[model samples]
Target: MDKNEKSKPSYNQDIIKIIQARYGYSQDYIRKSIRGDRTGIICIMIKDEYIRLNNEALKVIESQLYKL
Candidate 1:
């Protein structure tokens, strides 16, 4: 993705609201490396390099946003 595209939001509260309202809840689960904690929510901190490196993953995210 380009710089402008990368500037867009991915995992945030607004998206979370839309997700819950539309899909009800996430079926996918993620296990965090930290202390063996698991969460249905996908967390992303702004300005994180991983967000830029794995931007292709955002396609599904963008598609879901279109449903809102």
Candidate 2:
């Protein structure tokens, strides 16, 4: 299938919970950030840092985010 037609990965709740537990970030904050909502400055910073450290993770997250 073409890139546009390819099925995107859905949000993995287990991964989300793991991230939340490890980073101590609230689920609401993460969800909002993924949805491109304006979150706290710290939340944005943490998200950026996470993306920087894990490029593959960012891809999954972005895929899920865009699916929302």
Could you tell me the TM-score of candidate 1? Answer: 0.24
Tens-digit per-residue lDDT, 1-68, candidate 2? 66667664355466557668877878877656655575677668656754554677778889999999
Which residue segments of model 2 deviate by more than 4 Å? 1-10, 39-41, 45-68
Q: Which ten residues in a row have the lowest lDDT in candidate 2?
A: 7-16
Please give, for residues 18-48, the per-residue lDDT of candidate 1 as tens digits.
4345444442311121112443333322223
lDDT of 1 at 44: 28
Model 1: residue 44 alpha-carbon error in angstroms? 16
Q: Which candidate achieves the best lDDT against the true structure?
A: 2
